[model samples]
Structures are given as structure tokens and as C-alpha cells.
Target: MSRKIKVLQLQNRYNVNASDLAEQVIQGLPAERFEVTTAFLRGRPGPGEPESRAARSIYFGFSQSDLKGLRLRALWRLYRLWREQRYDVVIAHRFKPMNMLMLLNRCLRIPACIGVQHGIGDFDRAYRRWEARRLLTANWRIVGVSRAVRDYLVGCGAGFDAGNTVQINNAIDIDRAERLQHPREQARSLLGLAREPFIFGAIGRLVPVKGHIHLIEAFAQVQSVYPQAQLAIIGEGRMRAELEAAIARFGLGGKVQLLGAREDALQYVRAFDAFVMPSLSEGLPLALLEGMSGHLPVIGSDIPSLRPILEDCGGRIFPVGDVATLAKQLGAVLNLDAEQRRAEGERAYSYLRGAHAIEDFRLQYLQLIEQSLAAERAAL
Candidate 1:
């Protein structure tokens, strides 16, 4: 019998979507032909660190200085780990891990390297862009979470080999999402939400990119049309104080609530009458997918990353960062009858079932891994 191919998955942090994707990929691989381990490259666990499920897990415990500066020490530690493991293939999530893996791969001729880009418009630095082009060579592949991201990288002169670069949308565990979800009224009761209010909900970090302030502005306009409307943004970030001030400034203190981070936040999505994400940027946002998995009518920024999903799934879209347009969309959605809303939600769920099933995502990655290894052997 052929020996199993040993693999390693690396990410800079543990709680985010990248980690989640890595975990899913690890779990989904064929057990007989693949053996997988996982690692994190940075500081200690945060409040949101996911439960580890890899066959083995490692942490570099990088300090603040290591993360802020050139990260030379971290690189050294990674090099040692790579040397020790001698993995047949290394899969990296996000830029930091990808860049570091490239450096190591170039120096030591790592057998195979795969990088997954999880966000759109994330490369803003000239050096970072240059690095991407420089690092993509033989035995290396970059996977984009959306077609838009792959196109952007290729167009921007990232040296991704045309055959090697690919687009794979993020997938949610549909069964798990369904199991976790509560009925609308029960979910609302869990959150102490009144049954009378029309709740429009969003879940994500409270960062500038999420465009929560704009969502607030739009919700304010929504209130003018439907006084009983309430907006609840779940998740927390650096922008909390700023968003709070804006909510007060707009006199929406009574209608808008920032619920901060909750471990079970996705389960409560059922409480929303409709879901919204006003992100300025994204790469197939998992939050949006989770919302859709709950069969909620979604409203999202009409950027390239989200437009296709919204278009395919029967959801509403507004121009990015446009508060007025978002408000208009929200008002129009509110005008829909109960049957229309249910139809919209059903459409989203149906689209997800066909287009972004977890099994398809896993199969694609497995094929990529096998093909990459085959190419490496052919080159030899």
C-alpha cells in the first residue's frame, strides 16, 4: 500500500474564518490517503480561539514585537518546524503565513506550497504585491476564496501560474448550521428581543471595513419609514466606541444595539427577519454564508465578492458604502409580504445547497493537493 501523504496547515491566528477554513479542509481530507497537522504562528489564544481538531497542533507563541517588526525570529522558528516535520505539502491561509511559507520554500525547496487568499482587496502595500508576484513559482499555488480575488491577483501581476491559481468559495457546514439554529421566536426570546419589532441583524467584527456606521445610518433611515424596526449588530472590534457614538449622534440609541462578541452568535441568526452585511470588502464572507444558511433574506454591499452570491441567491444588493441606497433596499425589503420574504430566504438556502456545499469544497481541495503533488513529481 502507498504511504499516506503527510500535510501541514498553517495560519497566523486561530479564531477567524481562515482558521475555520483550514480546520474544515483538514477534517474533510480522506483519512486513508492523507495525514494532517495544524499550526498557528502568533501570540497566545484570544477569547475566540476555536477548538482544535487537527491530528497535531503547534503554536509558535510569537511576541508583540515579533508580529510588529520583521518577524525574523518567528521565521526562524517556522523554519525549524518545517525542517522537523518535513511535510509533503504545506497549506497556508492568509498573507502572513503564505509570505513566510514562500520565504522558507524558496530557501529550502519545500516540496509543495499552497496559499489561500481569504479576503478581497487585502493587498494594499507595494512590497506585499511585489512579494506575491515574486513568491508564486513552481510547486506553489494560490487559492482565492472568490473568483474576484483570483482575478484581482492575476490582473495585478501576481505571478500566479494560470493553471495553478484557482477560485474556491468558502463553505459552511450546512448540517451544523441547521442543528444550531433555533426558531425565530425562540431565538429572539434568547436575546431578550421583543416580538413586535422587525429585527434586521448583522454579524461580524466591528471594524472600519465592515461599514457598521453606514449600516447604522441606513437603519436610521429605516426607522423613519418603519418605527418598529430594530438593528442588532453582533460581534465586537476596535470600532465599538466610534459606532456607539454614531448611534447616539443619530438618536438611534433605542433602536440600534451592538451585542458584542458571542460564541453562539451564528445560532441566533434565526432571530433576524432579514440579514444585512454592509462590508466595504470581503471574499465570500462566512458570516454572510451563515446568515444565508439560516434561510434569511440577505442584503449586502454590491462589490464583486458579494454580488454574484447575492445575485444567484435572490438577495438584495446596494452599492458599497452607500448609506442611502442601503436604506432604500431595507425599506423595499420591509415592504415585502411574509410570503415574499419566505420565498427570498428559501431561494438563498437553495442556492447555497447547490453552489457551495461543503463536500464540493473538500473534493476540490483534495484534487488540488493531489494535482500539485503530481506536478512536482513530473518536474523531477
Candidate 2:
């Protein structure tokens, strides 16, 4: 009998939604043909936090300082682990873990090394691009979590051309997401929201990149026309003070609420009458996908990563960071009657089912891994 291929899935940290794609890699690969081990370079899962589902899991527990600068100690430790395990394939997520593996694999010669880029501008630095160009080999493959990310990598002059790069849209477990969601009434109650107001919802870090300020500006305009309209945002970040200031500036103190970071935020998605994502940039946001899974009419900025998804799903899209356009889109959704809004939401869910289904996501990853292994065997 052929020996099972051993694989390592490396990530920088364990975050709730951010880590789900790596976990999907673990769950996607068939057990009979492969054995997968997951490693976190910095932190371990906290209580009630989801852990890796790989056959085996390791937590490096390195501090932030350890991974900065030359990352000598981290590199040495990872090198020791790689030598001991002699993994047939290594899949590294994001930049740090991917860079470390690229450096070490140059010597260890891991048969197949896959680096997954979750966002754009990762290779903006000259040194990082030089390192990638120098260290990457025939067995190395780069995967972008979205088509925009793939294009960014290919155009970045970092040795990631069309030949070595592939696009794999991020996905979520639709069944699990739908099952975990609270019913609309229960979700609203949990969020301290009154059912009378039409709530426009968003879930993301309150950062400049997320464009929460712009979302607030747009909602301020919408609320003036429709006093019944309210806005609620989930998640916390350094920009909390700034976002609060914006709310105060608009005199939306009671009408708009920053719910702050809630664990399992997807559960409360049903509380929203309509979902909005006004991100300035993204590499295929899973929150927007989760919102669609909730069967809610959606609105988003027309950035490259979000445009196709929203357009295809029949969701409203405004130009990125354009508050007037965003407000216009929000008002358009507000204008829809209950049945019309439901139909629009159903269109989104149908598109999600056909395009971003977890089954298709898993099959694509499995095929990529198998093809990488097959290429290695052919070369040998």
C-alpha cells in the first residue's frame, strides 16, 4: 500500500473568521490519502475558541518580538520541526509563515510548498519581493485568496507569475453558518436592538481600511430621510474612538450603535434588515458571504474584490469610499418592499450556493494539492 502523504498547514495565529480558511484546508483533504498537521506560529486558541481540525496540531507560542526582524529563533525552531517531520507538503498562510517556509524550503526542499496570500500589498516592500524571487523554486506555488489578490501577486514582480500563481476564492461552511445563526427576533434581542427600526448592519474591524467612517457618513444621510433606519456595527479595533467621534459628529448617538466585538458575530446577522460592507479594500470578505448566507439584501463598495460578487449576486455596489454613492445605494435598498427585498436576498443566496459553495472550494484545494504532488512525482 502507498504511504499517506503528510502535510503541514502553518498559520501566524488563530483568529475566529480569519482562521476558518486554514481550517477548511484541514477538513477538505481526504483522510485516506493524506495526514495533515496544523501549526500556529504565535498564539494558541483561547477558551471557546475554535481549534484546528487537522490530524495533529502544534502551537509554537512565540511572542511578537520573536517573529520580527531576522526571526532567527523562530526560523531555527521551524527548521528543526520541518527536519524532524520531513513533511511531503507545506501550506503556509499569509506572509510570515510563508516567508519562513520559503527560506527554509530552499535547503530542506519540501516536495510541494504552497503559500496562500489573503490580501493585497503584501509584497510592497523591495526586500520581501527580492527574498521571494530568490528563494522560490520549481516546487513552490502561490495561491491568492481572490482573483484581485492573484493579479496583485502576478503584477508585483515578485517571481509570482501566472505560471506559478492561482486564485482560490475564500469560502465558508454554509450549512454550519446557517445552523449557528439565531432567529431574527432572538438575534435582535441579543443585540439590544428594537424590532421597530430598520437596522442596517456591518461586521468588521473599525479600521480605516474597513471604511467604517464612510459607512457612518452614508448611514447619516439615509437616517435623515428615514428616521426608522438605524445602523449597527460589530467588531472592535483601534479606530473605535474615531468611529465614535464620527457618530457624534453626525448626531447619530442613539440611532447608530457600535456593538463592539462579539464572539460568533455571524449568529447576530439576522438582526439586520439589510447588510452593508463599505470596505475600501478586501480579498474576498467572508463576512459579506456570511451575510448572503443569512439571506439578507446586501450593499458594498465597488472595489475589485467585492464588485463581481455583489454584481453577480444582485447586491447594490457604490464606488469605493464615496459616501454619497454609498448613501444612495443604502436608500435604494431601503426603498424595497419586504417581498422585493426578500427576492433580492434570495438572488444573493442562490449565487453563493452556485459559486462559493464549500464543496467546490474543497474540491479545488484537493485538486491543487494532488496536482502539485503529481508534478513532483513526474519530475522525480
Candidate 3:
């Protein structure tokens, strides 16, 4: 009997969405043909948090300082772990872990190495590009979570090209996501929201990149025209104070609500009348996909990552960081009747089912792994 292929999936930290994505990779591979191990360089699952679902899991417990600068000690520990396990394939997520493996794999000579890029501008530094160009070999492959990210990698002159880079859109398990969501009336009650308002909801960190300020500004204009219009932002961050100040400045205390971070935030999405994602940038946001899975009419920025998905799915898009345009789009969605809005949302759900289904994501990843292994065998 052929020996099962051993795989290592390394992540910098334990994040809810990222862990779920890794779980998909673990479950996608056939048990008879492969064994997978997942490792986190820092942080572990806290109480009530989900843990890795790989056949085996490891937590390095490295502090922030350990991974900074040259990361010599971290590298030594990872090298020892790699040599001991002797994995047939190594999959690293994001920049730090990928950079570490890129350097270590040169000495360990892993048969196949896959680096997953979750966002853009990760290779903006000259040194990172130089390292990638020098250390990458025929055994290496880079995956971008979205086509925009793939294009950025290929165009950055950082050793990644069309042949070495592939686009795999981030996906959610639709059945599980939808099942977790509460009914509209129940969800609104859970969020302490009134059923009377036409709520425009958003889910993301309250960071500048999320463009919440612009959303608030636009909503300020929106409420003046449609006094019943309300905005609810879910999630908390350092920007809370700034966002609160803006809410005060607009005198929108009752209209704009910052519903601080809540666990399983997606479960309450039904509380929204329409979903909005005004991100300044993204690498195929899973939140948007989650919103669509709830069958909500969505609006997003005109940035490359969101434009194609929104346009293709029959959702709305406005110029990034343009408050005036964002307000205009919000008003447009408000103009739609209940039936028209439901139809628009159904179109998005249909598009998501066809394009970003978990089954397709799993198949594509499995195919990539098998092809990478076959190429390694040929090289030998």
C-alpha cells in the first residue's frame, strides 16, 4: 500500500475565519490518501473558541518579540520541527509564516510548498520582494485569496507570475452559516434593535481601512432625506472613540448605532434590512460572502476585489471612500420595494451558490495539492 502523504498547515495566529478556512483544507483531503497537521506560531483557542480540526494540532506559543526582526529562535524551532516531521507538503498562510517557510524550506528541501496570500500590499517592501525572488524554487507555489491579489503578486515583480500564482476565492460553508443565523425578528430582538427602522447594517472592524467613517458620514446625509434610515455597525476596535466622536458630531446618536463586537456576529445579520461593506481594500472578504449567504441585498466599494463580486451578484457598489456616492447608492437601495429588494438579494445568493460554494473551493484546493505532489514526483 502507498504511504499516506503528510502535510503541514502553518498559520501565524489562531483567527476564527482563518481557522475555518484551514479546517476546509483539512476536511477536503481524503483520509486514506493524506494526513494533515495544523500549527499556530502564536495564540491558542480561548474558551469557547474553535480549535484546529486537522488530524493533529500544535501551538508554538511564541511571543510577538520572538517573531520580530530576524526571528532566529523561531526559525530554529520551526526548522527542528520541520526536520523531525519531514512533511511531504508545507502550506503557510499570510506573510510572516510564508516568509519563514520560504527561508527554511531552502535548507529542509520540502517536496512541495504553498504560500497563501490573504491580502494585497504584503510584498510592498523591496527586501520582501528580493527574498521571494531569491528563495523561491520550482517546488514553490503562491495562492492569492482573490484575483486582485493574484494580479498584485504577479505585477509586483516579486518572483510570482501567472505560472506560479493562482486565485482561489475565499468561501464559506453556506449550510452551516445559514443554519447559525437567527430569524429576522429574533435577531433584531437579540441586537436590541427596533423593527420600525430601515436598518443598513455593516460587519467589520472599526478601522480606517473599513471606511466606517465614510459610511457614517454618508448615513448622516441618508437620514436627513429618509429619517427612518438607520445604520448599525457590528465589531469593535481602536477606532471606536473616533467613530463615536463622528456619531456625536453628526448628532446621529439614535440613528447610527455602533453595536460593539459580538461573537458569531453573522448569526444576527438577519437584523439588517440591507448589508453594506464599504472597505477601502480587501482580499476577497469572507464577511461579504457571509452576508450574501444570509440572502441580504449587499453594497460594497468599487475596489477591484469587491467590484466583480458585487456587480456579478447584482449587488450595489460605490466609489471607495466617496461619502457622497455611498449615500447615493444607499438611497437607491432604499428606493427598492420589499419584493424588489428580496429579488436582488436572491440574485446574490444564487451567484454565491454557483461561484463561491465550499464544494468548489474544496475541489480546487485538492486539485492543486494533487498536482503539486505529481509535479514533485516528476522532478524526482
Given candidate 3, what's the lDDT at residue 285?
83
Top-down TM-score ranking = 3, 2, 1
1-380 in candidate 3: lDDT tens per residue?
99899999999997645427878878899989998989999988888877776788888999999999999999999999888888999999999999999999888989999999988899999988998999999999899887778888999989999888998888888888888999999998999899888999999998889999999999999899999999999999999999999999999998998999998899998899899999998775888998998899999998878887898899999999999999999999999999999999899999999888888888888989988989999999
lDDT of residue 315 for candidate 1:
90
1-380 per-residue lDDT for model 1 (tens digits): 99889899998875544327777787778888888888887644667655567778787777667866577888888888878878899999988788888888888787788999887665777777788777767899889887677877666666765687898878888888888888989988888777888899999999999999899999998897799899998999999999999999989987998888977688899999999999998765888888888998999998888888889888999999999999999999899998999999999999988878787888889989998999999899
Cα error, residue 259 of model 2, in Å, equals 2.1
* lDDT for position 66 in model 3: 100
Comparing 1 with 2 on TM-score, the higher-scoring candidate is: 2
Between prediction 2 and prediction 3, which has the larger lDDT?
Answer: 3
Give the worst 10-residue stretch by lDDT in candidate 3. 14-23
How big is the RMSD of model 3?
A: 1.7
TM-score of candidate 3 on Cα atoms, chains taken together: 0.95
225-261: candidate 2 lDDT, tens digit per residue: 9998999999999999999999999999999999999
Q: Rank the candidates by lDDT, best first.
A: 3, 2, 1
Model 3 bad stretches (over 4 Å) = 16-19
- Which predicted model would earn the best TM-score? 3
Worst lDDT 10-window in candidate 1:
14-23
lDDT of 1 at 224: 78
Clashes of 2: 0
